[model samples]
Target: MALKINKTAVKEAKAGDKPQELRFEDGLILRVQPSGVRTYYVEVARGKRVRIGRVGTVTPAMAAEAAKRLSVKVMGEGVEAVMPVRAITLEKFIADVYEPFVEHEHRRGKRTAEDLRRSFADLLSTKLDRITSRELDAWVRGRREDGVKAATIAREANQLQGALRFAVERKHLKVSPFDTWKAPNVPQGNVERYLTTQEKAAIRKALSDRDRQQARERASANKWRRERRYPELPMVADHVMPMVLVLLNTGMRYGEVVKLEWQAVNLTTRTITVVGEKAKAGRGRIIQLNDEALKVLTTWRALTNRTTGLVFQCDGEPIKSIKTAWKTIKKMSGVENVRIHDLRHDFASSIVQRGGSVYVVQKLLGHGNVSQTMRYAHLADEQAAKAVALLDGHKRGGR
Candidate 1:
């Protein structure tokens, strides 16, 4: 190891190949700091060192003894739990330890992995050994104080916990500091909101108006395009009634509905089977086609390529997203609170209101749990009311 010395002492010691300010030679490296304090560091390891203690005065003998003691302590602390420099540096650990674990959890969606990745992009670049637990605690505390949702903060904290656990397993960290960190409280309930019958009718009506307007605009545009002798008009019906009908008919998610394959869809049996990892639940389910859904499917199938292998593809590529079209449709339909997932809610609600049981609804909706199926229990309650009325009528007739 080496000791740092103040300048005046070095000049007095007739130091060779060293600055005059460096008074101490053994176990210390010198820096004439901007703050004017002669800071002291012990060279505990080769090319790696720790600041032992600062000595303002240039005392060579006293500094050497201090450096020797501090070096021994730093070395001892690291022998058991404290991580070495190679393990805790900014560039040293992120690529090696953190990102891979986050990505692995992301695949299974144990949490919102991508969101966590974005949130931690710069944060994890900090050196673990240099960063105090108090700094991390304050960072979390600041986020909470900034009006960020408690639930969101809790999830982020959980992700951090997972990262720390991974570090601990590799001994880069001694223990997960967040093992006892509390997450925000969340309430229980599967409360759902659905479009009323009138609301549903108004939306469909408004969609029709929007589709007609779109058709007119396309016709005008096509007239202009045809002057150049194009093979066909570029007028598309993808943003029309056919699309809305497609979503309402099949309770399939916007993503799933847009990416259906003709080979997977059995038009003869009016069944649509979807199998892909793109599903949020990561499981495929069979979609039953009603008359409205079937008609739309048939029309779409005939309108697109008979030679092409894929169904519902536009411009020769399978549709990946329809969010823009949905946004336009919602505004046209006059349903401000509507979401694409609400179409799914609409399907389950329709099934339940039309005398389907919760179990049937569960199967139709492809929910993993029955608790998710019970929000439609109110529909079954309607049947009980009908039964009660029938019983009252029979009792009166007997009297």
Candidate 2:
């Protein structure tokens, strides 16, 4: 039965064998359940129902006001106007919208999305609209307190800023809170580490020593196994020597070298084509093979029985990690400070020291920008000096 619902009538209402509802003006309705629980609802002219509150929690007057506002919204008076300003928690938007869009529409990899999630995990529960420059500053300060390097923190902050900007673009946020924020200051130039000639020789000697010791152990085990007195020993595969040589010569990143396939290498052309997917820049690059690099590849190819697949592998599969081995090798070789990436630096440094142009080094290193290649500029100072010397009046014969 339709009636104007008031507090007195709501209390006087009885629970029926089934559910009973009292309808009021302006889309307000008081529903009386079989258990005698009364709830308020706003039913629009279009028959869509929106729950207001419970009978005791919400009075008739409150329901009437909500009903009026809902009726205006249903009439298209200003319904679409308020959606953009609606605030959502950062966690909800990232999970419901941002991640899906990044994974599907943006064609970003799963790992990239996962990294972003980890970077912003602390702020996930905060409301998107409530985030401010001060919050971002605190986040940066926290990262510094945790001993993260400025460069790493800056990269993570840039990624977070990108995500916030995406939220603004999707109308999930009115504006990016981090739009005015500044990332932690990073060092202006790259810190290049390279191996000296003596250090390089020491590393080679260490690798050679390891190989000889393993070979002897294998030979001794074979002799004992043949005599039926001892179990056969497994032969150890040596990859460090060749891998180090390739990195030192090619200037390819460790990831690129490990993921290299046989098909990408052209011995006849004396070149390696680092594919776009494996390359850091997301673009393929050609690396010309020098004599040392070519020799290493030839030697490694002949040693392996597999005709196809990765150029470097363990148990016929691509190597997953070489950290432990690299650490041991570095310690034994007395090259304590050099990292694996320094081999690439060594390659570039070697080229520039030999009078190679910055452009040439940039091309060889597959750098997307010349600025990355400019760290080796100091190595080319002698070439610049020689050029200036050619202009000396004493050196030139009346030129």
- For candidate 2, the 10 contiguous residues with the lowest summed lDDT are 77-86
Candidate 2 accuracy as lDDT: 0.78
Give a tens-digit lDDT track for model 1, residues 236-342.
Answer: 66534666677777767665665566777888999988774645366777888899888877887776646336666667775544556666767776776565667
For all predicted structures, in order, the TM-scores are 0.52, 0.54
The local lDDT score (0 to 100) that residue 118 gets in candidate 2 is 60
Each candidate's number of clashing pairs is: 15, 0
lDDT of each: 0.63, 0.78
lDDT of 2 by residue, 1-399 (tens): 446656788787799999998888777888899998989887764555778989778888888888878877777854433333667888887778777877886656455566666666678788888889888887775554333458778888877788889888887788787767666564323447767889989988887886787688889879989799777766756787788789888999887898899999888899999988788658678999999899989888888754579989877776755566777788788887566777788889999988889999888888899998998998799778887887796656775
For candidate 1, the clash count comes to 15
- Candidate 1 segments exceeding 4 Å error: 1-191, 225-233, 276-278, 306-310, 318-320, 390-399
Measured with C-alpha atoms, the lDDT of residue 21 in candidate 2 is 85
Model 1: weakest 10-residue lDDT segment is 182-191
Model 2 scores a TM of: 0.54
